[model samples]
Target chain A: MFGEYSLSELASIFAMQGFSGLILFSVFVLMALGLAIIYGQMGVINMAHGEFMILGAYVTYLVSRAFGELPHALFNVYFPVAMVAAFLVAGALGAFVEWALIRRLYRRPLDTLLATWGLSLILQQLYRTIFGAREVGVTMPEWMMGSLKLSDTIEVPINGILVMGIAVAISIAVGVMMHRSSWGRQVRAVVQNRTMAGAVGIDTERTDRLTFAVGCGIAGVAGSAFTMIGSTGPSSGQLYIVDTFLVVVFGGAASLLGTIASAFTISQAQSILEFFLSGSMAKVLTLLTVVGILMLRPQGLFALKLRK
Target chain B: MLKIANLRSGYGASEVLHGLDLELAPGEIVAVMGRNGMGKSTLMKTLMGIIPAMGGEMSVAQTPLNGLKSHKRVAAGVAYVPQGRMIFSALTVQENIETGLTVTGRREAPQDLYSMFPVLWEMRGRRGGNLSGGQQQQLAIARALASDPKTLLLDEPTEGIQPSIIKDMARTLKQLRDARGLSILVSEQVLSFALDVADRIVVIDNGRFVHEAQRADVDAAAVERFLSV
Candidate 1:
């Protein structure tokens, strides 16, 4: 494939495709962060996680429409407000679901998987009934429109840059919470030993609920950021669910840095290959490579060093 | 203060503890001596609320502990160290101690805890798993005391430790009681350890206390008869 192109042409192709890969990486990180907490930390497989993301997207869609009717000066700030709303709504729903559904299924991974799969179906139909089946796009402010000219070979969209910024900020925030904060220590303690954590006066049950809620809330933020690059639809979350799981599982659980690393690797491989191969073919090849490696190392790229 | 009357608890369908009654005054050390599977651990776990009380009433200073969650029990000034030393192995020594302060909604391990177990102070930055069994035991006690609990429950504190460390631990227990005025309920198969530390000794068999005596009045041969296999 490289035989037909000049060196400069190949360089530009790589640079442009790499930028697109960064955008995909942002979305993957956002989607997978929540999974890392739920599946990684809590050992609960939240199959409806993608639906939570879509819930955030729908919330953003509504917020954008509402902002459209408001004063023109307010439009520039609507995205932030929508992101916050998405986090709260999704987190609240997650807490409720933990109480209603997931709590009963703890330590039963297969049950949580099946239960959450059913939950995903219910959420999809709920979204379909309320928002209709048709996909909808958010109205972007003029300031978020246009592209940044970075040399002659690259002109990146401003929204893509904004989404990347949001992803980075959230990643940093999560890392800080998991490492530096006292509550984070309790979360880690519970994840390590539930009975011991309770023995030490840490409310293990409440910790589990908050951790689940926070994970779902992160997914909502992911969905909100996702609106910049993709349209909102009831089934759109389903499109990314498999890919998000791939990023998370391949990255390994209980390690935030691992998720981000795997997302970057997978996104870059797919985007660059998609430029040369068909999109589906690119996806197939990337997945094949990951599967082959995973077969040899079932623990993924980073295994947690927890006590046995 | 700690009291239990007609306590019944067990694992699943087989009831291990059958109507056991016990009490401990403030700053007192009570050792429940028994053979393996004699309900010593069950009594401790039930007291801490780790296992449900099938039929019983337990109180710490007259505050009932039944139906309260384990964390709440800890918040109400009860701390537990289970058999095999159930330390949070992945956490640093300091973090493990800090976990005890969780009920108080505080994060810092008290300075006195460092002085109480200076080995733990030296190993504060190391993971609990990295410590020797004796050090981990000390860390476990530190974690328990970090909450400044009114009562402590320890299961097999001498299990899987060298005899020298066990002696040191007995000394530690006595010092802890005199310093903090804490009530301690320890289950042990090691009679010597019990004789060294406990103010009172009870021989438990089949989930009930069969023989009881003050530390000063305890007949070693009689207690040994109940403990022998």
Candidate 2:
């Protein structure tokens, strides 16, 4: 196969594949950011994060179905409306989970991990029971369906770029909220030191609920965006959870820079490996690499300097 | 400015503060001197609403504070600089200070607070965890001051700190008490520090306020009987 291709042809093939890797990396970052907030910031391992994404995807699916029943002129403008609805639906469910369960498990990291895992199972079952076990395909509008060509043979999917843009935008917005807003301060206070935060009059419970919800809501948005690249189903979140967790843990908990760096590194590694090895082998190699890194940097790439 | 009457509180099944009665008049520095596990910290927690008051009435600035959450108490003008100075290890000194502003909804940090602790202002960008124990304690006190509470609670402020920093903290507290007329309720194991700074002293052992006296009246013998083995 290599003998038939010139150097320029190989370079172009790698470049095109790398562009696709960047898009996948963007999605992985979005999915992990939410997990980072809930699990890394609050130490609440939200195993149900993927389910929250699925919820968002399903909301987008419903919106699309509703738009399909409308006139062609009306359907075009309804895209923004569907996006908003999907975000709200996911956020609301995230808030509900926080209020009902997350609030009760403060300072219980292992328990939270187990509890959220159970929540993920329940959510998957709920989705399957309601929407059936078959994958649900969300139809995109005519304008969002094709690819954009940059050169003689350089083509990029428009949906991939849109998803990547949304991811970057969401990441920036969440970063600002964490560092700049009053809510962010409270969340940081809670994450840094709960007892002190409480003494200073921060409603740690309320902050925990809001933070967890925000994290889940963002995951939902990622799921909604992902419908363009992958199938949407009750179990859609399961496909992303491993990659999402890998990115979050690899980056280091509670650090946005870590998440971004990890996503970029993992995406490029997986994409490049996919070119040379089988998909399963590429994934295995990525996992082994992450595990090795963790073994060395137990505090992660960016450690939260906790006083003994 | 702050009053607690028959306030009862506990951790799980063990009652730490039982029917405690305490008061801090505006502009006054009141210290609670007791040994470890004597409910001094618990009384402070109950007043700040960190621990739920099990029974009896509690009031801050004459308003009922029972059933109100900790943050509500903060909004109602109560701030606590807890024992061990629980500063956010990952956050910078400036960010740690900003945590106090969350309760105020202010668009900017109060510049007056920086003037009070110039050291914190100098090291504003330094991580809280990187600071020395003395610096962290200063950051904790400064954070409470940022909230600009009517009543300030300091639990073991001078504990595990250098003597020079302790003197600095005492002076700062005196200035804050005089300039702002901020009522203070400090819990301390160091009786000498309390004797020098406090206007009145309250003594507790096990789970109750066993004695209350003016600072001038609290003799070394009396404090020794309460705090020492």
Candidate 3:
């Protein structure tokens, strides 16, 4: 591999690969943040989380198609409107799921895993029946198109920069919400001790429902962003589910900073390695490394020191 | 004020509190004394709606609370400090107290809560997990008081606490009762602590209130007989 390329060529390749890795990092962070909230804070193994993401993608697809027929000026602002719609639709469904299914399985983590896995399949089939089996793509606004030239040999995509900005904004928003908001205090309380949270007048059940909804809403926004890089299909969300879960677990549950850090590490490793090796091999090696590290530490990169 | 009539509750199929009746007047502290596994904590849990009341009626300040959920019961002016403190260990002391304010829709805790447990104020930025057991207990109490509840239910507040701190806790409970007109229902294994703070004592055995009397009129020997293994 070293002999195949000259020094200048290698530098440009590495630079381009690094920038691509950042784009991948943005998607991983967006997906993992939602999973972290559900699995880490609420302790609910939501296997249907990917399906929730797909729902958002489908919503975005619908919004974009609807805007295509309207005035040309409407197309520019449709992305934000689609994002909000995706969040609301996905969040409403999440709240319903919590009320109907997740609430009954609070004490049974494994049961929730199985039930949500079944729910994921059901949702996939529902999408297939409604949206068809074909993958759909959204038209990018004019501002989101084109690339910026960095050097004589290296250039960066505007869409990639946009996604990175979204990821950073969302991560900071989540951190502030978790630390500074009153609702976040109630969520932390319930996560630590449900019975005591209830005793102290915190509506533990409501807190749980809202947390789950917000987590799903974030996943919706992630899916909306995904349209810029990948096409939406009934099973597109499934492709990213395992990697996102790995990001969250390898980061350390309940640690927002850890999630972003882990996403960056994993995405960059995979992106760079894929340039030299096959995609599957790169993924396997990255995952194996994470597993090896997790086995030694078991608490991931940053564990919250909470009393049993 | 709090009132319970023939309250029955338990874990799973096994009943722990069998038609137990109790009452508390405004500003009065009632101590439920019993040995382990004798339904002392169960009574407190049931009162707070932690465990469903299998059968019976409960009211706080004339508001019926029989069918209310735990949070709704808390909103009905009842607050509980469960056994082992059960503070949100990962949260900072200030955030832990803010849970109370959040539930009650209040912007901040009362200034008196900080004066009552000054240690909490000193370590406000520290995580609850980092606190000593006594400090955690104080945090638990302060968290409960932040809700400004009409009634407080405390389970084994003095357990594992230092003697000096226990005295201070007793004094704080007395002061809260006298100053705020808050009714308190506390369950304890320590006889002296209960006697030190309670206006009335109820002795429980085998999930029933077998003996009840005013603190001044109670026979110490008879109460000890119910508590002794």
Predicted structure with the largest DockQ when compared to the true one: 3
Better of 2 and 3 by DockQ: 3
Tell me the tens digit of each residue's lDDT in model 3 across A252-296.
Answer: 987888998999999999999999999999999999999999999
Return the TM-score for each candidate structure.
Answer: 0.97, 0.93, 0.97
Against the native complex, each candidate's DockQ, computed on alpha carbons, is 0.69, 0.62, 0.73
User: For model 1, how does the per-residue alpha-carbon lDDT over A7-42 read when each residue is reduced to its tens digit?
Assistant: 988998898899999999999999999989888889
Alpha carbon lDDT at B152, candidate 1: 91
Give model 3's docking category: medium
Off by over 4 Å in 1: none
For residues B2-118, could you state the per-residue lDDT of candidate 2 as single tens digits? Answer: 988888899988888879887789999999989998888888788877788889887778888898888888888888988888888778899888888767877566888889888
Provide the lowest-lDDT 10-residue window in model 1 chain B.
Answer: B101-110
Fnat by candidate, in order: 0.77, 0.66, 0.85
lDDT of 3 at A188: 81
Q: Residue A279, candidate 1: how far off, in angstroms?
A: 2.0
Candidate 2 or 1, higher DockQ? 1
